[model samples]
Target: MSGYFVTEGSKCKGRPLTTLPVVINRDLSRIINNNLQLKSSHDLEHLRYIAQQRDEWTKLTARIQEAAEASQSEH
Candidate 1:
């Protein structure tokens, strides 16, 4: 769910940034897109790091089974 929201927000945010360079100058658009690509590559690496951390957490917590059982019992 958080991923979906972030992707939607990025789509909206990217539109104006991309449109601005295109409206101002053709060459500028290429430069802006290249920078965006580099930023996206970094973002991908960051997300992978986050996923690794999450997997570590799951290992530490026994795959969250305790929390799930507690929630089920509460209901």
Candidate 2:
């Protein structure tokens, strides 16, 4: 998925706002699922990595939600 940010604003009146293109890597679904499976299987070797993946997934989803809210507010 993708996101947008309003980077700059017009100093004068009747001018458009400047938007910056923000790209988000949203390809962690499979990885997250795999991590969940590993955890369910009681795999202790990669527990640290699995926890990290879960945290990253959480942050990514939160950012997605924030972006959606921002877009709605813009409209």
Best by TM-score: 2
Candidate 2 segments whose C-alpha is farther than 4 A from its true place = 1-52
lDDT of each: 0.41, 0.41
For candidate 1, give the lDDT of residue 74: 83
Poorest stretch of ten by lDDT in candidate 1? 29-38
The lDDT, on a scale of 0 to 1, for candidate 1 is 0.41
Query: Against the hidden reference, what TM-scores do the models get?
Result: 0.27, 0.32
Tell me the TM-score of model 1.
0.27
Q: Which pairs of residues collide in model 1?
A: none
Q: Write model 2 residue lDDT over 1-75, tens digit each, in one string.
A: 012222357455775544321112222222333322222213333434544798865765565576666667989
Looking at model 2, the pairs that clash are none
